[model samples]
Target: MNKWLQVSFVILTFALSGQAYTDDSKVSLPDDSIYHLDSEWVTQDEQTINIQSLSGKQQMVSLIYTHCMHTCPTIVATMQNIEKKLPQDVLDNTEFVLVSLTPASDTAKVLKDFAEKRKLNQDRWTLLTGDPQDIRSLAMALNIRYKKSDDNEVAHSNVFTLLDEQGRIVFQEVGDINKVDETVARIVSQ
Candidate 1:
């Protein structure tokens, strides 16, 4: 067969294969990427998505609960501080992810209310809740520890982690979130 006919046959075969050949090349995630987790998460907007869906941009993440009245608030404030300190371009590409430590109670509706109450702009922020096990798995991956009390209060560590586009932790603050804005800014700027 002629070269032109051979190329046409291959193209038609791929077209008939549907979405399989739509992409030119498949991008592989790193071994350490959290995006590899096969867990379903529900966003405040009520959309179901996997961690892999958040893979394309840098992420600033913290684990907090809607009912927390102590260090959680301070941790969120520190996250906001870092968010505000980043350059406009960096901020544009960076997303702030707040994962619920109490998924059993932090449903989509509760998360929405918390977001609205705190004036978290949906464009730059995402609030997520998932199965209890999925939440725990993610928390473990981030090295965030949490335990529920008799009063339904969760005592968790204060952690602010920066994840690069590949979903690998770039920078993390375990207990102290003070005076780390500059470091977070510098890392996410690239």
Candidate 2:
């Protein structure tokens, strides 16, 4: 075989393999992934980010109102505990997302205050508030039911949902924080 021909064949094979690898890396999300929701949210820092922007990391998602006097605080505490239990590597690749059920009242400033009061790690914790309809749509997609009570509190179901790196719900626990170990296991396995 001629030297030039051999060299050219090697280069061509490498290029083709590179192209194949690139194509394989672009995996499509599942049809039911939360990234399919076109909702816009404002972070505690007042930055506008779309729901799909959170697609690349594992996420622990919950719906809450900053002003709630009961279940909301419990939910936040439970999430914090879960964060503490996660392995550092899993924690590094995970985000804890709290979406406001009362978007009208849970402004960016309010969310910021709530985050500060709870001593949440702002880097890993995202508190979001957006259009009421968008919030409602997100809650519905997560199967979280909630309503405003006469006393001005949000009466919501207690639940914690774990979304895989691709934004598909991998595991969800309804009611108390008893499933923290299971949630951590799922995240680590992912």
lDDT for every model? 0.82, 0.85
lDDT of candidate 1 over 36-122, digit per residue (tens):
676899999999988878878899899999988888877777777777778787888889999998888999999999999988879
Q: After superposition, how far is residue 30 of candidate 2 from its true place, in Å?
A: 1.8
- C-alpha TM-scores of all predictions: 0.81, 0.81
Candidate 1 local Cα displacement, residue 130, angstroms: 0.6
Alpha carbon deviation, residue 188, candidate 2 (Å): 2.6
| Alpha-carbon shift of residue 173 in model 1 (angstroms) | 1.3
Over the stretch 86-176, how does candidate 2's per-residue lDDT look in tens digits? Answer: 9998898899999998887899999999999999999999999999889888888888888886766887889878888878888777536
Instruction: At residue 134, give the lDDT of candidate 2.
Output: 90
* Residue pairs with clashing backbones, model 1: none
> Candidate 2, which ten residues in sequence have the lowest lDDT sum?
19-28
